[model samples]
Target: MHMSVANVVIIFSIFSSAEPYSGQPHIVFFVVDDLGWNDVGYHNSYIKTPTIDMLAKSGVRLNNYYVASHCVPSRNMLISGRHVIDIGLQHGEIGYYPRGLPLDEFTIADKLKEIGYATHLIGKWHCGCYSNHSLPHNRGFDTFFGYLGSSDDHYTHIIMSNGLADLRLNDECVGYKYFGDYSTIMYANEAKNIIAQHDENKPLFLMLAFSAVHKPIQVPDVYMQYYKSTIHDNERRTYAGMASCVDEAIANITEALENKGMLKNSVIVLTTDNGGGSVGNNWPLRGRKNSHWEGGVRGVAFVYSDLLPMDVRGTENSELMHITDWFPTLVKLGGGNPCERKNLYGVDQWEMIRGMEPSARGEVLIALDTTRKASEEYRTGPFKYDKFDITTFAAIKMGKWKLLTGDSTYRNFWDMPDPEYGVIDDEDFDDTRMVRLYDLVDDPSERTDVSEERQDIVHEMLAKLDGYEKAAVPPQMQTKPRLDNHVLECMGPWID
Candidate 1:
C-alpha cells in the first residue's frame, strides 16, 4: 500500500515527533573523489550511474550541501567534524608532505566505536597518514584496507607522481599483489568481504572512500564500452567509465549489505569529497575543483535509509547542510553523545535529516586560506573590488549571500565538451573582481559580483571571516622531505 506524501507527512506529525538516540543503524558512507555536479545520471541523464541514481531516487537529496574545495580539508572536516581553520589546514591540502589530520581530534569512527559499532575504512584515507598516529586504524576504525595517500593509480595501485606503491591491508603494504585488479572492483570486493564476515550483533560503520572518477582516468575496457558512443572527448569518455565502475561497485556493495541483513537497519550516504576537476563537468555553475565557487564546494550528496520518514523520502532538501554535520548526526544516531568531545564545530542534524525540523545551521565557513597576503585592508566605504586587497583568501555563506575574497585558484566555469549539455562562453567571464559577492539564492552560478551593491552584507561576512581568522591555528604544512630509499619503498607514513 502506498501513502501519499502529504498524507504521510500529516500522519507522521500526528503520530510521532523527533526521538532521542534509540538504536544503532549500520552506517555505510561512500566518499567519491572529485565527482562533478553533472556526472551522476540523476543530475545529467547523459551519464550512466544506475546504482547511484536508484539510491538517490529513494534517498533524500541534499541540494544545498557544502564541503571544502580540496580533498584533505574536506576529509579532515568529515573525520574531525571541525573546520579547516580550527584544524590548521587553512593553507592547502596535505600532499607528499609529512602531515595529516591532527592526532588529538576524535573521529566519527571513534565515536561510533564507543557505541560498540564495528568500524572499517575501505579506500582513500586522505585525512592524513604521515605517521602511525594519523592512520585510519589509529583514528578509530577497527580495520583499514586502503591507501594512505592523496591519489593512486587505479590498476597498478601506485602513487604515479612518485612511483610508489600505496595499496595496504591494515599496516602491511600489499600493492605488489593487486597489480592488475582495478581499485573500483578491489574496493568493492573488500567491502563485501567485510560485510560478509561481520558479526551481526554489532552495528557496522563502513567508510568506502572510492578513488574513482579522479585523475589518470583509468578503468576497465568493458566499462568504457558503456559511454563510447555518447561521450566524444577521450578523457571524459574514460571518466564516464570510471564513474560506471563506481556505480557497479555501489550496486554490489548494497547487495552485500542486503545479503548480510544490514540494509533494513542501514543508513547509506553517498557524497563526493570535493567538486570535479578539469575532465569533469559542473555545468552552469561557476568554477571547478579548488575554487571558492558553488561548483567546487557544493557537494553532490544524498542520504538513503529505511528509517527516514516516508514523507521525506525522494524529496530534495534545500536547507543548508555542511559535511561537518555528519559527525554529530551519525554519532547521535548510533546512540552516542557527540558532546563528549570539546570544541566540535558540527551540530546534530538528525531531526532535520528526518524532516522533523528545519536545518540546524544557516551559515557555513566554506574555506580559509591565510597564506596569500593582501596589499591593503578591507574598506568600509564605497569600495572598488580591485582597490581593497583581501589578506586572507576565504569564502563564507550566510543565509542568501555568499562572499569570496582574494584569489580563488581556479575561477572559470566548466561545462562538458559536448554541445547539448552546455557550451562555455568565452565572453561570459570577465574575471576582474577578486572581492566577489553573490546572492546564491538567486545566482547559484556566481555570475554577478554584488559586492558594490550590497555593502552591508559584505561588511557582515568580512567581520565573520575576521572572527574566524582570530581563532584559527597556524597551518601544519611541513617542508617536503627529500625522497630517500624509504620513500621509494611504499606510500605509508615515512616518519613513523
Candidate 2:
C-alpha cells in the first residue's frame, strides 16, 4: 500500500538507549550487482539460490523495494541517503571519469562510526575511486578489502576495460596475492576473516557488495556443473553458476557470523544494486537494467534479523522503500539518531521493517536523467509539443500513480531463455510514447498507460518533476586521465 506525501509527517519514536543489545545491532548488508528479480528460488525461477531463499523465508521479504536504474546512482543513494539528482550523479555510471561521490555528504559508515560502530566494507566499491579522498578507507570504513572499480575478471581480479588489477586491502593494492581465486570465494574468505578477527564488544557494520552476476560471466567449474543439466543455454548456465557462487559466499559468511556468536544480534540484509542484466532474468517485470521500468529499479531484497518480532518474521512487507532509506534505517538500528542530520531523502524505516507501522515513505523519485537526449522526434497522446526533444528522462511514483517522461532507454518484456517462461510481445506494444502513466498499485508489471485518461495526475506529477529539476544539480565533469605506467598496472587512487 502506498501513502500520500501528506501522510508522511507521522513521527517516529526513537529507540531508547536501554533497548536490547544496547540498541546497536551488528549490520551485515550484502549488495549483489544486477541480481535478477526472478533469479532466486523464492521467486520460483530455475536458478539455485538456496542460502538466499532460506534466509529470506526466515526473514522479511521486501516486496515493494526500489532502487536506481543503474549502479553508481543506487550506490550513491545507498551511501548518502541523498538522491542522485541532488548529488549531480543522475546521468549514468562512472567509468574512467576521474570523479567520485561528493565527499561533502556524510556516508552511512561515517554516521555509524560517529556512534562507536566498527565499520568494514568488503567487495565492490563502485561509487568511485578516482582520488585518495574518495576511497572507501577515507569514507568512514575502518577497513576496506575489495575492488575499487565497476567490475573485473573473476579469477584474475583484473579490470578488462583498462587491464589493471583492482583488488585492495585498505588503501594498498593486493591483487597479485589473489590471482586465480574466484572473486565470490575470495570476498567470502575475507568476510570470514574479518568476522573472526572482530572485537565482539563493538557493534560491527559490514557492507559486502559483491561483483558477481554483473558481467564477464565467469564461475568455477564446480558451480557451473551444478546448473549444467537444468540450464541448457551456456550463458544462462554460467550466469546461474555466478549467482549460485554468491549464494555459497553468503552461506559461508552466515556460518562465520554464527560461529562468532554474532548472528543472534545481527541484521543481515541482501539487496541488488539494480535489476538483472542481459544474461540475468527479471521476468514479467517489463525491462532490464538501464531503464526506468519496474524491472530496472525494483530490487530483489530481504532483511534477516533475530531482532524482528516473532509474529512478523518470514512475512512480506509491501510498503514502499527506496535504496536511500537504508542509510537512516541502519543508523537507527545502530542506536544512532538518524535525524541528527537534515536534508536526507531517506526515512527511518526501522519501525516499518519491525512490522509496527506502515512505511513512512510516500513517494519515490525512481530516476531523473537530464543528460538523456532524444535519438529522434516522437509524439503520442495529448502531448502536443516536441516532448521527446525537450523532455528529460524522469520517472516518479506518488501513491498509486507512477509517471514517466522522456526516453526510457530499454523497454521490453524480458524472461528466462527457458521456453516455459518466455513472453510473446503483442503487436499493439507501443515503445514510442514519450509520456506514460501507470497505476503501479493495479499494474505492477506496467502493462497499460493511463496518461490520456488522467491528465490531472499527469499535470500534478509534471509540476513535481519541475520542482525537482529546478533543485537538481548538474552532473560532475572530469577529464579522462592518461594511462601512465603506474596507473596501467594498479587500480588504486590515481590522484592525491
Q: Write the per-residue lDDT of candidate 2 for residues 1-496, one digit (tens) a residue.
A: 1122222212101111112455578999999999989888899557777778877877799999999888999998999899988888887567777666898888999999999999999989888887888999899999999898888998999988778888999877899999998888888888999999998778999999998988999888788898777887777789888988898888778777766878777898999989987787887687888888888988999998878887777799999999999999999878787656458889989899989999998889998777775544664446644322325788999988898887654656656446244554534756566778999889988878898899888878877887887788898774565335354688876666
Question: On a 0 to 100 scale, what is the lDDT of residue 400 in model 1?
Answer: 85
Error of 1 at 18 (Å): 19
Error of 2 at 418 (Å): 3.1
**All candidates: CA RMSD (Å):** 5.3, 7.2
Off by over 4 Å in 1: 1-22, 374-389, 416-432, 480-487
- TM-scores of the candidates in the order shown: 0.91, 0.91
CA lDDT for candidate 1: 0.81
- Candidate 1 local lDDT, residue 494: 60
lDDT of 1 by residue, 1-496 (tens): 1123344334334323333224678899999999988889899887888778867877799999999888988998898888878888777657766667788889999999998999999999888776878889988999999998788999999888778899888889899899998998999999999999998668999999999888978988887888778877777888988898898888778777766767767899999988888778887677778887888999999998878887888899888899999998999888998867567788888788788998999899998777875544432235434233354578999988899876654656557445245546546544444567899888888777888888888877887877888788899866765335354688777675
